[model samples]
Every structure is written in structure tokens, then in C-alpha cells.
Target chain A: MPPDMPTEPIRRRIALTDDGPILVHGPIEVVLTDGKTMISDRAVTALCTCLRSSRYPICDTSHRRRVRNVTARGSGSGMDRGGRGC
Target chain B: MLSSTSPRPVTAPALPAPRGPLSSAVLAALRGISAAPHAAEIPPGAVGQADPYGEDLQLALYCCYELHYRGFAGVSDDLEWDPGLLGLRRQLEQVFLAALGADVAGGTDVAAEIGALLVEPVDAAGVSHHLRHAGQLWQLREYVVQRSLYHLKEADPQAWVIPRLSGPAKVALVSVEHDEYGSGNPDRMHARLFADMMTELGLCAEYGAYLDAAQATALAEVNFMSLCGLHRRLRGGLIGQLVTAELTSSPASDRLVRAMRRLGCGPRAIEFYAEHIEADAVHEQLIRHGVIAPLLAAEPELARDVVFGIQASTLLADRFADLLLSRWAQGRTTLRNPLPELSHRR
Candidate 1:
């Protein structure tokens, strides 16, 4: 490592909201436990908390509703992820 | 900013041909040899008589606003602040504001408004819904062309309000603006991505290329942004417009990505909406809690303006969607002129 380069892991601010995605400031790539990596190049990115998102790691606004109707037909994915669209 | 540099020269688009008497008058002034037209007062109430949402007024107003964004080819850039053009623009804005103010039911309940926006309408009949279900490639192309009027210059109108804001509200708005500007990567800029999609779809990607084909409804959406963002009094209105866009963009963008994939479009075509789905999702949250909350907390009085912004934008969006859907229902083109037929190449 270069002498000027800090040998410490930089502490970053990640805001955890009461409900909805956990907000991380600046671009980040999350390596999930399942070994799938999700990279978001945005200045800020949202990680869905509800587990209903078809986009998985990143929030696709699936968590907006109070309770997404269980039997709703379209998830905007047009791809049925098993039982229900929502 | 993107590390790699491009060789091609970036230039402003040419002035569009006029649609009517009012637009013709604007075009004449812009194309003339003089930097600013000699101050000649027109007949009283001449502007008020023009339809608020008509093509003539919309296009005329668009030309004035365009001077601020990217001056038309061969037109004087100095005209952006020219008194004669500014005077004409003010008259146009008054007619538009009066009409919109009368049409929408105004309120200061920003929380309730944002809550309503969060819910996706089950029985929605919007253009995005139609596209997601069963819209043709040509129709989609035409839709993209009309939208390019604004998307080609995305984030620019809203940038005007930055100077008008301060404290946490200012910081929050700038945070979102930074993302919209591609978080320091110029190549990833939303406008560039939109242009990439246009090229992939075999449509002209040049800015203002489709201005002539854009109807009154399309121009009204962007005009509203310019109108609100330019006025310090309408800062709340600008935030309202931004809120509506960020809140609604994700779902609609998801549908658009599906539509593009369903039509077997190329990667570039699909990439634009795909990026929006993720980007706008973050933006939605930032706009609601970051920008709006802090703004209203500082100045509790701007609530009515905020409501007016949301309601006016929503009405305009519905009008735009209705126009496209109705035209497509009749098996007709939504544009004033049909798009140039796509050239086939491997």
C-alpha cells in the first residue's frame, strides 16, 4: 500500500428508516449472502426491506404500498415470481 | 464525469418550423438578424385570447424557454434575457397560470398528497399501462420522441430552483440533483441514456429534433417545469412537480422496460427505463422526506403552491396519456407528423 493511502476501512453513513429500504449515501455494490452482487451507481441507493421486490436487493418501489394486495395481477415485471404478482 | 472522451461535436438543434400565428411570430423574432426584436406592443388581450393549451401558445412559449436551455441554431443566445421576448413570455405564462390555477383543486396537505401518489391505481388506463399490456413498436417510438422534448434536457429545469433554496432543503435537493446529473459520471447522465435509447430505436436523438411533432400536451408538461422552477414564489410548486415525477417514474419505468423487452428491442432501448426504475426509486424517497419535508418545515406557508404544482402536473400527464391512447385506439399516429421510417441495417 502507498504511504499516503490510509490502511483503515472508511466509516460511511447508512441511514436505516423505520419502514422501507435502508438508505446508503453514494454509489455502492452489495455482495449478498447468496453470492449475488448488486451494484448501484447512483449517488444514493435504496435496499428494499419488505422482500417483495422482484428486483431483489435494490428497491423497485414495491415497498410503497401499506400492504400490496396479495392477489394483484401485475407486478410491472410481467414475470410471475411464483404465487402472486405483488 | 465519464473518463473517456467522445470525438463527435455536440451542438444545439435547429429551430423548428412554426405551427401557427403565435409560434410564427416567435420564430420570426428568433430567426431575425437583430439580437432582440424592436419593442412593439401588440394588441391588448391578444395573448389571453389564445388557447392556453393550444399548439400555438405552447410552441411559442417553448421557443422562449428553449433560449435558456440550448439556443436554437443561428439564433442569438442573448435573446434568452431580451426584453421583448421576455415580455411576450410573461404574457404567455399569465394565461397558462390562470388556466391551471382555475382547473386544479389546491391544498397544503403535502403529506396526504404524497400518500395518494404512493398508491398505484388498480384501474389505471395510462399510456404506460397500455404499453405494458399490448402497444406496438411504432407507437412506442412515437411516444419516446415526444418525451425526448423533456428527457433530452432532464434535471435542467429543476436546477433553476437551487439558488432559491437554502439550509437542509438546499442540501437535500442538491443531493438528488447530483444523482440526476449521473453522480459525477457524464456518460451515465440520464439525458445521454435517453439519447442512446433514441438511437437504438432508430429515432433521431438530436435535441429538439421532434419539437414540430410534439403536441400541446407534451409541451405543457415541460413548460410547467420551466414555469415553476424559474419563479422563486413557485419554488414549492417546482418541488411539487419534482415529487410527482420521482414518485410516479419508478412504476411507469418498470412498465416501459417490460414493454421494450416484450417488443424485442435492443439493450440501449431497454437500458434507459431499467435505470430509471432503480434511480427514481431512491429519488422518490429523497424527494418526499429529504427535499419536501425540510422545505415545508422551514416555510410552512408555501403549501398551497405545492398542491397547485402536484395537481397541475397530474392533470397535464393525464391529458398527455389520454391523447396518445385515444389516437392509438383509432389506429392513428399520435404525433403531428409520422416519424421517419426506420432504416433497416444489420
Candidate 2:
């Protein structure tokens, strides 16, 4: 390491929620699997973890559970596959 | 050289016409025509007998709170602190607060309350849902007008609690507020965005332009924010209101964005809700983890008040939504003054 450079690496903290997004302290540049990059300059950014968000790479709160009544018959699968139908 | 047009002119809103005796008296006091009623002058039974959520009480309270934000065009600025007005405001607040306290099932389980807010009912009948699925452009326009009462001055009411909070909670809350204020960019401010959307929708974008048209239900919703915000003791409740707004806004905003697009609305009209889709998604996390956690840790006693704020605000929101939905169901205009028909702009 060069003498002019700091000896310690600066650490960035991110928070994980069980039912929601991963909150990363931003301005962060997120690169997707297809090699496309998106940047969020917000003070904090919520990266979608559920893959259900309409605004992919940013959570639009699509992770929230949709409650269907017991008698309601359809695809009983819990996750909404139609991308929130907004 | 840049042209020197002012970005936003500082025109105070016009005074709305009085709804009833209480609002008439309050307006008279604001106009400096008659002295505000002394405590004894108001019959003790008058405020008690008035429906807590009725036009008279809600309008009176709204006028009083308006003094703090931007005093009406002709109203004297000094009257904001007038003892008589304040006294009447206090009586009005007592009745309003008592009604809310009686209505809500009070508790201290902030986690449970938040958890419940997170679940979306599959068959939700909220205003946004109606707008997205089955609403017409006129109905959507009316929604904007009623909401303009709050959206035109967004993020202002909750700002009252900033001074009342300490440590990390305050820091987190301010960060969220900074975003609401457009992160130092005036044009991107949420209030500005809302005004732009209103203009795009062919509605008047001026602050308080629709006050006369807005009903008591709409005024009461904004009044509740001002009520909690102005009181230092109600800081926890204010936070509760803030969190509730942040938590629920994202998905609803998404729905509204889709509604606008489906109705052939332009980008300027959809921008406000479109921005909220991501902005509130981030804000929800900040408020829950960054603000609420440390706030409760520092003052656990506030949990009950926070819960009260959440439930009461939710109740008010539901009432507002119900009013709009039911009125729309009858194919009637929801505003006190029906909006003028929009010429074919789409």
C-alpha cells in the first residue's frame, strides 16, 4: 500500500429485512446480470429482493403479502407471479 | 444572462367561505371584522354539541391551522398567535382528540400495527385500486383536487416534530424529509411535483385553490396532521402518522401511476406518483428501522401514543377514502363545488 493511502478500508453498512428489501446506504451503482447498470443517488436505497417489483432494482413495496380468503379458489401459490399488476 | 422570472411566487391563498357558525366566527376573526369569541362568550355546550367531524368543526380547525402554514391573503400574520383564536382552537382540538381517542382501539404494539399495515388485502377496495381498475378520468381528476389540500403543502406538517426529536431518530427523520423536499432541488420537491401533476390534469395548481370545493373529510385529514404536528406532546403520534404515510404510499402510488397511464395521461401528470414509487419504498425502510427503532429504544413509553397516532390517522384515511368511493359510486361529484368539465386535452 502506498504511504499516502489510508491503511484502513472504509466500510459501508447495509441492512436486511426478512419481509422487505435490502437497504444499502447510497449513492450506489447496481449492476445487473445482463451487465446493465442502474444508479440510485438516494440517501438510502431499497434493492428489491423479492423479484416482484415493477421498478426492478428498486423496491416498489411489491414484497408485501397479498391476503386471499380461505374460500377463494385460484392459484394457491403465495407469491404473485404477475409482477404486482399495478 | 438568465431571465429573472421567479420559480415559485409567494402568493398566500384566498380565504375560503365559512361553512357554519363556528367557521363563520373564525373567518370573521381572521378578517379582523369582529373579535374572536371569548371562552365564556361561546356557550359551553356549543363545541360539545357540534359533530366532531362535521363541516363546522373541521373547517374552523383547518382555518386556525392554516394561520401557521401560510396565512390567508387578507388575514393578518400576527393573528396566528392571537389569544382568542388559540383558545377556540384548543376547545376544537379537545373535542376532535376526544373523538379520535374514543374511536380508536388504543394499544402499544407498534410492531403488530406495522405488521398489519404491511399486508395487502387481495380484494382491496382503496381509492387507488378503484382508480387503477375502473375509474374514469373525471373521477381521477376529482381525487387530485381533494388531495391537493394536503399534497400542495406536502411534508410540512410532519416537519413540526423535527425539533421535538433527539439523536438518531431525528437524524433519520430529517433524512427522509430531505428527500421529500427534493434533496435540495426546488423543482423536484414533492409539493412542486404534485402541483405539476395537478396542472397537467387540467386542475388549478395554486395552493388552497380548491379549499372551497374540498369537503370536511379532506380538511379533517390534513387537520389531523396539523393537530398532531403542532403539539410537542404528540410527537410520537406525529411519527406514527409519518410512518403510516411512508409505509403505504409506495404501492398506492404505483397503482396511481398505472391509473394515469391507462387514462392516457401525460408524463407530467404521472411524475408525482411515479417518483413516490421508489422514494417511498426507500422512505418506508428508513422510517421503520432508522427512525422508529431508535425512537422507541430511547422512549419506550411513546409506543402507546405512536400506536394511537397510527390507528387514528388510519381511521381518518379510511373515512376520506369511503367518502370518495361512495360518492363516485353514485356518479356524483365529490367536491362541494363540482369541477368544470375538462375539454379534450388527452
The alpha-carbon deviation from the true structure for residue B32 of candidate 2, after best TM-score superposition, in angstroms, is: 0.5
| DockQ scores of the candidates | 0.19, 0.23
RMSD of model 1, in Å? Answer: 5.2
Q: Candidate 1 lDDT, tens digit per residue, A1-86? A: 88999888987669776658888986688999899887876778898889988787888888765434323321121221100000
Worst 10 residues of 1 chain A by lDDT: A77-86
What lDDT tens digits, residue by residue, belong to model 2 across residues B44-100? 688889899999999999999999999899889999999999999999999999999
Over the stretch A1-86, how does candidate 2's per-residue lDDT look in tens digits? 68898778677779898779998885899999899999887778899999999898899889998775522312111211111110
Clashes of 1: 1
Top-lDDT structure, candidate number: 2
Docking class of 1: incorrect
- Top-DockQ structure, candidate number: 2
The Cα RMSD across the true interface for model 2 is: 8.3
- Please identify model 2 stretches exceeding 4 Å from their true place: A1-10, A69-86, B1-6, B341-346
| lDDT of candidates 1 onward, in order | 0.80, 0.84
- Which model scores highest in TM-score? 2
